[model samples]
Target: MCSSSSSRTIPAALAIFLALLLHWSSAQLSPSFYDMTCPGLSDIVLDVVLQAQISDPRMPASLIRLHFHDCFVDGCDASVLLDNSDTIVSEKDAVPNAKSARGFDVIDAIKSAVEEACLGVVSCADILALAAEAALGRRDSTTANMSGANNLPGPVDTLAVLQSKFAAVGLDDTDLVTLSGKEP
Candidate 1:
C-alpha cells in the first residue's frame, strides 16, 4: 500500500539515521582506554590535582570548569590546550576562554608527570577526562570565540539559556542539572 515517494523517503531517512548512529558510536569514551598503557594515570592526575589545590584552593573548581568548557567546544579534545602558532590559532584566546579559562599550567604539570611515568602513552584529551574523574572520584571545546563564549552561558543566565548551552554540546536537561550541582 506504499506509494513510490513514501518508499524513497523511508530509505533516505534510514540512511541518514544510520549515518548519525555510526558517527555517535565512533565518538564513545572508555575508562579502559588506558588500562593497559598507563595503569597509574588516574593516581598521577589525582596527586597533581591535589597538590595544585594546596597552592590555589580554586584549582579544583577551575579544572572542573576547564574540562566542561573543553568538552562543549570540541568533544573533550585537548584542542583547548594548544597555544597559538604561526600555523594555528589557539583556543585559549577565544572569547569564552580569553582570561576566563585557567589551570593550563596545572594541566601542563600533570602532563609532564604522566609522561615521565608512562611516556607516549596517555593523551591530553583522555587526561582531561580522567582528571575530571580523579578530582571527583575526588571532583569534576573549540576556538570559535564569539560562538564559543556565546555557547557557555553566564552566571546570570536563565534556565532556558543554560539549557540551550548544554544542549548545544549534546547534553540534555538531566546533564545540565547535574553540572549545576557540582560547585563547591
Candidate 2:
C-alpha cells in the first residue's frame, strides 16, 4: 500500500492540512486531498522503494502504509517493544523488529554506530530526527534519476497509497484512525 506519484512529496502546508483532516475524519476515508500532505515523504517514499526490492510484489504502497499507520498511531515511538514496552497499543499487538518499522529503530542503531565512530557528538533526536529530512532529500534524488521526475510521489498520495495497500494486508481501518505518535 504505497502512495501514487501524483500525491507524493507534499508541501509543509499540505502536511498540516492533512493532519487536521485526519482529526475530523470518521472511517478509513481516502486521506482527504488536503490532509494527505504528509511531511515525511522522503523517508516514506524511500522505504517503499527499498521494500519493493523484495520478491513478494504485493504492492509496496500497501506494505509501507501498514508501517506508517502503525508508526503514526503510536506517534512513531521507537520504543514499541512487543514484549518490553508497556505503552504499545494492543490492537493487533504489533510485533517489534526490522520488519514493521525501520524508522526510529534503525535511527537508534545508526546513532549508536555513529557514536562509536565519532563518539558523543550527536544527540539521539538529532541523529534520529534528521532521518526524514535526509531521507526525503535522497528520495528526491532517486526520483530525479528514474525519469527525471522531480519526485516520485506527493505527500498525500504517499499516505493514501499506503492506506489502500495496507488495507489489503492485515492492518484494519480502525487501527489507522486511532494512530498516535510522538511527533518528530
Give Cα-based local distance difference scores for all models: 0.65, 0.34
Can you tell me which runs of candidate 2 are displaced by over 4 Å? Answer: 1-77, 81-99, 103-109, 121-125, 134-184
lDDT of 2 by residue, 1-184 (tens): 3235423622332354345334433353331211234333334434534454353333333333333433333222222222323532332233322243334334444555555555644333223223332111110000101111112222344556545533544444453443322111
Compare the candidates by lDDT and give the number of the best one.
Answer: 1
Instruction: Summarize candidate 1's per-residue lDDT along 1-184 as a digit string, tens digits.
Output: 3357755754554443333323333433456667777888888999998898788766766776676676566555677787777665777877678888999999999999999999977778767756655211111123323356446756677888888776776766755554553221
**TM-score, prediction 2:** 0.28
Q: Would you give me the overall lDDT of model 2?
A: 0.34
TM value for model 1: 0.68
